[model samples]
Target: MNSLIRYQVEDGLALITLARPPVNALGQTLRAAVLDACQRAASDASVRAIILHGDGKLFSAGADISEFGSAASFAAPSLPDLLSRLTQLDKPLIAALSGLALGGGLELALACGYRIGEPSLRLGLPEISLGLLPGAGGTQRLPRLIGVAPALDMMISGLPIDANRALELGLLDRLAASADTLVEAARAFALDLLGDLAPARPQTPFAEPAASVAEDFFQQYRQTHEPRWKNRLAPRLVLAAVEAACVLPLQAGLERELALFKQAEDSAQSAALRHLFFAEREAGRIPGIAEDIALRPVARVAVIGAGTMGGGIAMNFANAGIPVVVLEQKSEALERGLANVRRNYESSVSRGKLNAEQLEQRMQLLVGTLDYADIADADLVIEAVFEKLEIKQQVFRTLDEVCKPGAILASNTSSLDVDAIAAVTRRPQDVIGLHFFSPANVMRLLEVVRARETAPDVLATTLRLAKRIGKVAVVSGVCFGFIGNRMLEPYNREAHRLVLEGATPARVDGVLTDLGLNMGALTMTDLAGIDVNFLVRDSNRSAFADDASYYRVGDALYSLGRYGQKTGRGFYLYEGRQRRDDDEVVALAERLASELQVERRLIGDAEIHDRCLFMLINEGIQLLDEGIALRAGDIDLVWTNGYGFPAWVGGPLHYAEQLGLDKVLDGIHRYRDSLGTYGQRWFQPAPLLERLVAAGKTRIEKI
Candidate 1:
């Protein structure tokens, strides 16, 4: 491996460059060498000022994720040790940040007396996403420098802010034209800091209220907000750190922050969250993919439908500056879809994410047509028709007749045999799937389904396009809902089964909500239209009234005309569009339970969360066993990005590790005993699960 740190002193300034390619992730050797360099700079008599910078694509992509779950000591002075040394040195310290300065990178920048960055630099402290708080001086120094409110917002949300925004907020002292020139600007800035009036650490106490920012900000915000935190770990833990900084001295505050950080890093919640993060990136890979598969650039795209999903898919292409030709079945639906597109653009303009001119530019990029002839010039054609296989076949047949040679044909099918859809055309190699979640324009996930006949280049082009549209492309093997919804079937099945086993819809929903899913499976069904899942389920003999042990509570709700938020009703009733708990629904569940002669027990909240989640983990293992998913990490990504699994929990596999596989298998067996034979297949442990159970392994990748 290449060395990460190098130090040089000249012209009264010392420069320390983190030279790790890609990102200077704090791996074993880098950690030790960087700390050694920091010490050398501190001891050098000729060094008047210090500058820390990174080489290659980014400042750093935080800690080397590969080093996670290991007990390797930092092998260098701790962040606190280095930071405290920086402050005491007679020389000023300047941090030159470029690209992304995230996690430990942000913490490192906070320790410096000054920060300068390129206009494109993206800065963030995203420990919250990993189930930890900043363990370095960030918790103590950031609030004091930037005020508590903004710091709390940045810390809690973990969203990266662009450099211009950082400059406005005083997170950066100046901006450069490009990332490569940042070091030159930092050298100049450091020279300016070489005087009696050089920049000094702020002496203000953390509690000194900025008339505009104070404790009341959080107090007031929480009052009007429903307790929406998925769990008490991240949000509450972060708030406590911020408060400690407000009152304690810097040394004590840092100590307090470190203690909290340790607690979280070792916590099951943090482990789960970390697993989810790795799982998402893992989703991008496919087994047996040739490294030579070349991605063709997609400058123009065409869509064959104009429903909500179609319109949204069109928006993705147009918004990314790819010209679009939307082909609908009729002029009226085309007109309606085009009108909705305009409304969406105007709404975004109103919200200031776009300007009037930009909206016009995006609209200019989009075109609507009623004829298949318009698609001949497109680089790609996506079929976003209804979920019926016949409809997709007809669209593919039309595209086969009309599209230019080598044009990639794709389907936005959530669940259906994509290979069968590809078979409708002579050029099956050009066809693939890009399964966007509901409200396609808003969700950050895209399931890139790969059929066996699909050309690698076509799959590669689709993956690149997915990233361009701001979606995480998790490559998936063909199955119902591919990886995400396929695993979700068993999960949703169990939730419905619980209702008949004595739990109510409310109880099940609450348990999931508490566990950190965006909503309970039942409520999510309501939002997605209670009938939508049936479209997925009705395929492949898994539909309701089947002898399979599958359960779908929403099926009954839909049969009763409760079609979710759009119909103003679902598993729960709604007042107008607002969801309200329904006593009638609860009473109906009771009636069904009575007819089944089932016993209702006082199930604890933790048990409900674990049981529902473990079912998915079991299926994830099976998917891996069947090679529907390449790895455990791929399944994790599917759950994290598409299924609203909490990011900090790391994903289902990581969460299972924290719970211990033996414990999870034990629970599955317990549930099997009560749920019966169908439960045996649905809840049975995978071979890997069995191995982990036998070995008593608490986490994967530790060995």
Candidate 2:
């Protein structure tokens, strides 16, 4: 018997326990063991039924993702073959699910005659997020149990449902009181089904939906979601598999689903999405910290300044069940900030995202305060005050006087120097940058800026805390804009220069959107507030003054008080919230072109895409070489999570690898020669990029 699977037969019942530690991911070894267990169960004369249960916290987290695209995944006793063997067993089989039974785990359960789940179990087929569908009979078996529409929605959304919902959907045969009792409950459930029928014959026959209704549903789903998926083929392939299940016999549908799965698995989209999946997990790892490093407990959190950023930051702790004290200088500002938080929660309730009770519970965790003394006991104090050095210094100095000795001090600064901010406080080790993007609670990315004097424990605790709040935390050495915004500087600068060189705002934005970006640089600038970018540029004037045309369009917009969506005019005019092309803005761009002595000329979409994207990719190469980012994967995670970089593109670094370093370097040189001094200044290839090309390296990992 394999150690991963413990099998025993007693009282006419065979028990097969998946004893793998952590998540019992369905790997080749585990699959082989499972198949052997089924064969042994079938041979035992005393065994009337079999129960399958995992020994650890979860049944499984699904397929061992590391095995994907590897030879091991296709080895003997593969998941599909093992599941087929289980289906062919003479004895009845019951799947005892607990914690998480997702993807392949869920598929395994579907293959069983019965499924008994813990009440708190999380169940789903979430392979869609990784740009693949549940390949192992999920497409065929799921719709056979649940209705076609619900099954399609579940797989399409790639979200997990609780045990109660799973039971309601006819996915679970029974629900156990708790995970601890799930195995016993499965045995009890199996007793009722003993000697019922042969294992090859399923209890519930596959039901085909009406052709008209099924066709309508599939067509509607495709028409509505195909555009959003952009260039990706996984979603469309998933839809095709589910459609096959509705029309074909079980065996035929399974074969068709297998074909589609193989197609999706081989696509570049799947590979890139898989890269990001691993990158997100890898971002949490730090260089010096041990896995067992003690983390500081953050039970109470204090957020200074109840503005938009502060209020959002407070919600993160409040949602995590930590008490938060939101401090503001004035009562009116405090009330206003609290009101916005309430409205945000209320909006979520209206959207069916949060229950009223949950909203109340989270709001109760928040305490509005005007006194520093009120937050003296906070375990963590974060200042989301005005983005000025002196303003932040004063807040930290006050915190130094009031906060307890061991409290963590974090600044939510996007571009400011963490070392400079740490100088104001006595405890520099505790003063780290917890840079949360705007609408902090909603954004998944959190750059945990490690300062020069930051303690290892501080970083360890912050990384742990970020996970608690459902964030993807990537560590960075402190610098202007850290990682995401630092690279974004050149990317945005090129967008502005493109407009001045005669590309319309609509054309520039259209080019990027066609390249699979969520929005164009000009569109994002308008949404982020044009005046905000102007201020960021204004503060860094000394560093950027050598280039006269640096954000000339932004300076002109700021001078005209055209502050984007807020002011209803920036790069484009706005009606309510929708943007419209403004002739005035276009005329302004032409004026800047004349002032800069650059002839206004037509630019192709390919050039627009390459110039902007390649510039961003080059900067990421520079950051990796400077050690500002720990790894190339870290840069990928930062851009994909923090900025709106498309996950399918893998991120600037990974995308550069796909485009080839030699091609990127050649394009940069061409731009430098064509545009003279300005292009020479901005488009000089990073040393790392040149070296990677010289060495004939193709991947970002090689660099």
Candidate 3:
């Protein structure tokens, strides 16, 4: 018996157990062992049937993603070949599933003659998430077991279905009464099959669609889903593979699916998506913090200030079933803040995201307060007051006096120095920054800013708490704007500069939106309120280049009280949620250009795209070089999740790699030479970028 596989035969039944701990990922070694065990069972005269089960929690999560793009993935007896051999076995083959059976693991179960699962089973074909379709007979076999619609939904959505739903869809032959008896139930099922007490339920080539597929279903599916998956390759290919199963035979469909899978696997989109797949996991790793570090308990959280951000922050803990206290200086502000939280929860209930009971339950977890003493006992307290430095310092000093020892004090500051804020608190080791994006309860990204004296346990606890609250957390060293906003400075500068250089606000935004950003720069600023951005810029004015033209358009807009959507005008005129181009904003930009003695010139889309994105990429490289970001991948996670940077292109650094480091350097150099002093100051390539290109390297790894 192979070490990865355990084989045993008893009472005319051969049992094959996948012995890999954790998720039993179907790697090359495990595939070969499984094939060997099946061959032995076929040759043994005493074995009348065979049952396959995973030794622990999950049957398998999927193919071993670590082996992707490596020789081990394509070694002899690949997943497809092993599954094919299992289908050809003469004896009854049963798959006993518990926990998760995803991607190739589910494909393995589909290849078996019978599948018996525990009620806890979560089955899915989620290869599409990695920018690849299911290659190991999943696309071909899934539609045969269920119909075309449900199979396509499962593959495209990359979500798992519970065992009860799987049984309803005919994906499972039977579910065990309980998890503990899953294998025993599978053994009983195999004996029934061997003794001819139950009908043989062969699934591979013999399975048929549970219902007839509509002739126009494929076309309608494309029409409905194509817009959502624009610029994405894997989802389109998955639709084709599922459609092929409806018309073609199983063998032909399998071949077609493999071809599509290989095509998607080789594409740049898949490569980028795979980069993020690993990057999200890699972002949690802190170099100095050991994996075994004890974590601080965050049982009760407190948020100071009953403003928009504070209310949103409090909701995060409330939704996570943690008790939270909202502190405000005035009772009216506290009432308004709690009312906003209730309205947000009510909106969710109306949208069917929560039931009435869940809404009330979450609201019950939140407590309104007017006293700092009331929040002194909280395990964690986050200050979301005004963004001024002195104001934050005062709050920290007060917290230091009233808060219990070892209680964490976190700031929701976006660009302000966290180390300076920590200086106010005597327990600097307990102080950190948790920069939550606006509408914090809704956004997915959370920047866990580690201060200079931040203890390892606090950092670990915050990372864990971020997961508990359903946020994608990335650690960053203390710096202005940390990771996401720090890089956004240059990108936004270019957008504002481009508008001043005779590119209309619409034109500049349109170029970036066409490149796959969720929204244009100006549009995002407008939504976030231009006045807010203007204040942020003014607060960090000392960091700007010594030029009057920098962000002049935004400053002008703020001066005129045209505060984005709230004021009905800023970069664009807004009527409700719809925005229209305003001639006054364009005229204002032209006036600023004339006043600054800068010549106006038409900017093409290509220049606009290259300048904005390359500068963003350049700043990311600088962040990596300065050790503000731990790795190149961490920057990718910050941009993709926090900002509207397209996930399909990966993060800016990953996009730079795909665009070629040499080309990125050349673009920066071209602008630096062409734009005189301004370009010379801002467009000079980062030392790391220059080094990578000089070394003839195409990939951007950590400096």
Kindly list the per-residue Cα lDDT of model 2 for residues 474-581, writing each as its tens digit. 999988889998998999999999899999999999998887888899999999998899888777887778897858988999999998999989899899878899
Which ranges in model 2 have alpha carbons more than 4 Å from their true place?
195-201, 210-215, 701-703
Q: Residue 339 of model 2: what lDDT?
A: 96
Candidate 2 vs candidate 3: the lDDT winner is 3
lDDT of 2: 0.88
Q: Score candidate 1 by lDDT.
A: 0.78
Candidate topping lDDT: 3
- Strongest candidate by TM-score: 2
Model 3 regions more than 4 Å off: 195-200, 203-211
What range of 10 consecutive residues in model 2 has the weakest lDDT sum? 205-214
The digit string of per-residue lDDT tens for model 1 on 1-703 reads 2367778888988999899877887666776677677667778888878898888767877766655455642335655565666676556778899898988788878878788999888998888877778777777777887778788889888888999999888888889878777888998888877755675454533345234365476677566442776464866778888777777877898889988877877777777766666666666566666656778768889988988989999998888888999888799999999899889999999998899999999999889998888889899888998889998898899889998899999999988899999998999999999888878888888888889898988887787678789998877788776888888887887777777666777888888876677888888887787777665676755443544323435556768887888788777877776778877776666666666555556666766776788888887877776677777777777787778887666678777776778888888888777656556546667777777677767754322
lDDT of 3 by residue, 1-703 (tens): 8999999999999999998877888988899899999999999999888999998888988899887667776678888878888888888889999999999999999898889999889999999888889999998888887777788889999999999999998899899998899989999988778778543345333255424566677778789889877578889999888877877888888889888888887788888888998999988989878989989888999999989999999999999999999999999999999999999999999998899999999999999999999998999999999999999999999999999999999999998999999998899999999999988999999999999999999999999999999999999999888999989889999999999989999999999888778888899899988888988888788876587576999988998999999999989998999989999988998899999877789789999999999999999999999989989998998888888888888889999998889999999999999988889778978899988888898888654
Q: Rank candidates, TM-score, best first.
A: 2, 3, 1
The RMSD of every model to the true structure, in order and in angstroms, is: 3.5, 1.4, 2.1
Clashing pairs in 3: none
TM-scores for the candidates: 0.89, 0.98, 0.95
